[model samples]
Target: MTPVLYLDFDGVLHPADVRVTASEPKRPRVYNGGSTNHPLLEHAPLLERILAPFADVKIVLSTSWVRVLGYEYTMQQLPAALRERVVGTIWQGELLQHPPRTRYDAIQSDANNRGVTRWLALDDDTEGWPDEQRYALIAPNNFWYGLAQPGVADELSQALALLCAGKPLESRLPQETHVPSTVERIFGLG
Candidate 1:
């Protein structure tokens, strides 16, 4: 079975709160408050670097960008290396006519249709993902950091290694650690 990675653009490659102007629908801009002002796909190089050694791994677009911007336009946004790895997209033709409820559902349906037994998803949306299949999801929960978040690249690399090795993906996402406000920190209450 060919190893597949379901890639999300909004929250995986860049910040989740991205906006595209009516005049420039193809150009996506990030609006993640004032936390982190990362350019679109600012972490693309990191992702590209991680996947460089795994030449056989294929990518499947599971992002809403493909639905909103069209497949070709969305594909153009990726760097050459990542773009070349894209085998297909989840939002096209029949799937577009009848879209899935959640990202996980779309990927699951696509994987089953393609007979892909070894696959994982790099996404931030965890709404409909079940606990049993959580092992296949590498979630960069912080919208501001996305793939740049600490340990996310490592998690993705490790997952890809496991997938290529034909090993069961059993790693769960690390528990979130809370960062206290400055006030709490100063008062030693955190």
Candidate 2:
């Protein structure tokens, strides 16, 4: 079975602390992102290089951008190398009208519907992911810094290899500790 990589754009492709413009958002000054171009396109080469060896590996969009830009447009935004590897997105058009409780559940629902067993997810947010599913996630440094962090790419590469081998993907960093409810944020009640 071809391995599927669930990719997030905001934090995975570029830093989450980015500025949005009418044309294209401005990416923050990343530490080692290879390029200082648009945030979305800057880290394309890095992802390309990491997945180059795994030719059969496919990418499934797990980013909120898919809801706004649509799959075709989002695919077009990716680097040529990464674009060719994209199969589809986790968020189907209709589902956008009614999002799941968590990002992990959304991806899992899509993967299950597609019968995709061998898969991995890379993102900065791991909120709502159960412990078992957390094992497959390669959480980024933080929202502000992504693969720019030292050793991030190496860690991602290693995680990819392990996921491809069907081995458990343990979290090196702490899991999403806790996610407060919307009411808590709104009313300041825990």
Candidate 3:
């Protein structure tokens, strides 16, 4: 079976805009994002590259942004032809108000209803999954205002391979420890 792929906006697919915009009601040099067409929009080709190995996968979006706005707005970032390839969507309206225990559950529920298994989720906020099952690709900083680097999508693809083989994905940066040993380290954590 082709795995189901859960697509997210924000850091996973879209990059946070670090630039200040004139339309802002207040400040300058402030950034905004998780919405589509941020600079990370340049990275979308990564999605097509990552999903290529899966023969029958279905694409499902788990982004709350879509629900907050709507398809019309979301589609603005894509070329007309690219938008046509999207198959199914789960809007923010379809979700429970409190973030759930499984972003996987959200995706899995959609996959189950569609009778799909072998799924992959790409998310910035994986509020739905418990700590142990955080097997999907989670942005390292755990913040919404960043972007995935180029290799990340490849690692996510590798993780899907690992999961299908009944193995867990080790940190792609296994040698890189994130925890800080001192309070001074905490200051630079972001």
Candidate 4:
């Protein structure tokens, strides 16, 4: 089975908090209170580099951007290399149901429907995820750095390597504990 990667755009591809003005909807601005000087999709090349050797891996969109920006427009934002790997999305165009499902639930349902046993989710919303399945989640610090967070790229590469090898994901790498600096605390990036 080809390894599947559920990709979240806001946090995983770029900074989490992106704002767009009606005058310039095409160009979104990221404000982290000057904590980091990274551009939109600044970490995309890193992701592209990591996935370069794993040619069989497929990507599934799991970001809310699809709902807000539309699927085609959202896909267009990705670099050509990453965009080509996109196979589908988690949003099935269903009407909003009462008591919205969490990211884990959506990913689980999508995986099950597709019979995908080898899959991982790179997301920031660390809510409603069961303890046992935590290994499948690569959550970046969305409030601040997102994928640009130190050690995140390495962890992602390691996880992808393990996944492509058909190894059990339970042996996931340990996450480095991050203590926010004074500036980060002031900006609420911690």
Best by TM-score: 1
Per-model TM-score on C-alpha atoms:
0.86, 0.76, 0.60, 0.81
Question: What local lDDT score does residue 81 receive in model 1, on the 0 to 100 scale?
Answer: 95
Which ranges of candidate 4 are over 4 A from the true structure? 22-27, 33-38, 95-99, 173-190
Model 3 TM-score on a 0 to 1 scale: 0.60
Best by lDDT: 1
Where does candidate 1 stray beyond 4 Å? 33-37, 171-190
For candidate 4, write residues 45-116 as lDDT tens digits.
Answer: 888998999999999998877766677888998999999999988876452232247989888888988899
For model 2, the superposed segments whose C-alpha errors exceed 4 Å read 18-39, 170-190
The lDDT ranking, best first, is 1, 4, 2, 3
Model 1: lDDT equals 0.89
- lDDT of each candidate versus the true structure: 0.89, 0.77, 0.56, 0.84
Stronger candidate by lDDT (2 vs 3): 2
Q: Model 4 Cα displacement at 22 (Å)?
A: 4.7
If the candidates were sorted by their TM-score against the true structure, best first, what order would they fall in? 1, 4, 2, 3
- Spell out the clash pairs found in candidate 1: none
Error of 4 at 163 (Å): 0.6
> Model 2, range 1-190, lDDT digits (tens) per residue?
7799999987777777544345654322333345345445467788888898788889999987777667777788888888888898888855677899889889888888889988888887789989766667877866655765667788888878877777766644456666779998899886
Flag clash pairs in model 4.
none
